[model samples]
Target: MDIRDLLLELARTYDEGKGTSSGVHAQDLLRRAGEEWRHLLPAGFDAEGNGGSGGASRTPWIGVYDPDITRDPKKGLYLAYIFAADLSTVTLTLQQGVTSLQAKLGEGEKRRRYLQSRAKQLRAGLAKDLVEGWDARPDFKCDVLRARSYEAGSVAARTYDTAAMPTEISLREDLWHMAEVLQHAAAVERNLRDEMASSGLPVTKRVEGEEEEHAGLDGFRPKDGSDYYVLIRQRKIKKSRSHEVLVRLFGEYIEERGFVPITKKMHPKDIVLRRDGVEWMVEAKTVKRGNPTKAVREALGQLYEYSHFLYEEQGKGEPFLLALFTEDIKAYAPYLEKRGIASVWKTVEGWAGSPMAVAWGMVDEQ
Candidate 1:
């Protein structure tokens, strides 16, 4: 039998079985046969070769045997043998031996076209809705109106049909309007709070319109509208420079402890924290479950450089700490340790809770 015919037969057998053990075996055999054929063929044949028995034997082929999509209840498996004239990619039309399969393929193409046309219509309708909606609204303000004016004056609006104009113009206008409105609202709230703070009254008490809730205001507001002096005391106690979540946690643990943990303003890569009044360099690393790549190794090297800088250049006689924070500690711990690098693994607890360590490093002896 011809090599191509043999491959097709194997694919057909596999397809009839619907991916059973025999089907998988057939597939493996077909793959090996293809690989062997490619090895025998000259490399230049793929680029451009003469049309002869050797070239005919080297027809590009893929064997697929799976459950038929067209068959009622999809009984016995079917095999698909696709052949191309050249090694370069080509679409095969299976016009013979699989009439139902061909019909299904045609149906699929039609459905795809239908879906594409429907998507275009939906997009056009959405664009129209946005423009008409914004124009209809009397309260639209700021950069939105400015952008709309520009869009309305553009060449596309004048030259193209209503459906052909880009949808982005409407979207940009709506987004700009929303941004301006939100900015105004925020400004109003901030002004109100500042004014209340100056008037010796709690901002929470002066409920002029809707109450504005700012971050870190929880547990700071007093039940009774007490003197602004009382509110100020609470505010000072709760305020911290870090993220609100971090601030709240630090507030509960470190407040009144006299341990003024200075929040480093510099990048983690640049900042070096001091221990015992001496410059102590620490490298912070965060990793997920995947094996460390070359990028990770580079980052680790960068951290090492930062540590060396602190010790040699700054003359801060303190040990370095390599803090490795990871979700999966067990998987990465061994890998990191193999590199002779000491690491601290921290597991995050619930929100606003402290991170619990599966294992941590002692002060680096090196």
Candidate 2:
């Protein structure tokens, strides 16, 4: 049977009691489901199915494993297809291994809180729209500790009602995309580990949003600009790992062109490119599909604000303002130029930029 049929059959026949006829049937069907799911596995990945230990389980699942990250669900990141307690819906999820967190943080509420917080932080690495309809924490009727842990450790998921399951083709596509997303997360996590190592800090010792010495800037210096501090405090700046990735890439790109790029802890700007005693402040923003304008709008404001408070107001002179985007914001190039902000955005081949940005030698014309 296909995926839809398998899910429907299992959902219709699932029994909660141990060793019941329906329970046995559910176990057999789940095994077949897991076997079928193997076809959807990406290269170098493997799959496993679990119906229950001795009896039946409230949540039966098939786990897809990347050996580099984990082959066991108790220790690392993996993809899982989990059936709800009521069998009303089945969700495909990218989830962390909760036992590992428990080992590190100890069990109970402390571990639970850390699980959710870590998931939220890692979720930032993914694009907003990529997981727009998914839950960051999926609670599949946490009657058992395993079920509760699954809810606590969820990173992202797409759920489908059993009454209307998707076709096998769409299921395959979703699995592929989810796997790619998992791979991206792995790469970013490794980069962060390397960064921590280079800074001579243990990976476990770093904390997000930890207080650090503020960079010398009007917005950050309370005595220099209380108004700036008040304004900044009121504005809730959303942190994003996708934004970090873009900034790093852009910084490397500029550095390759013989410019020095600087980013410091608690820095107001994304990047500072310097050459020949001249500096350009860059604000990097990641673009979501169908929302390039929103990215441009945000970057524009940041570019202007940083230039004013970090440079112009401080008599550092107006450093050149540049807005960098993950994708082409060329549509707003003219709009930004009229306001004295140079715009440069990424393209598959190289980079694209506003005329002023090109003239300022920020990016090569594509």
TM-scores for the candidates: 0.24, 0.50
Give every collision pair in model 1. 15-65, 15-77, 15-78
Instruction: Tell me model 1's lDDT, rounded to 2 decimals.
Output: 0.30
Shift in Å, residue 296, candidate 2: 33
Per-residue accuracy of model 2 over 20-110 as CA lDDT, tens digit each: 2443787777666646654334433567767877676888887876665677788768898899998898899988787765555566655
lDDT of 1 by residue, 1-366 (tens): 333334344434433223323235554455455343331211101111111122122222332211111111121111122322222221111111212322332324332332233222322323342323232111112233221222221111111122233243332233223222222322232323212345343222113455344454455544432333345333533221212222233323322333233345533332344435633233433332122343246436755654554344456453443433322234444555554444443222211111211222132122
Off by over 4 Å in 1: 1-280, 293-296, 329-331, 335-340, 346-366
Q: Which pairs clash inside model 2? A: none
- Local distance difference test scores for all models: 0.30, 0.70
- Scored by lDDT, model 2 comes in at 0.70
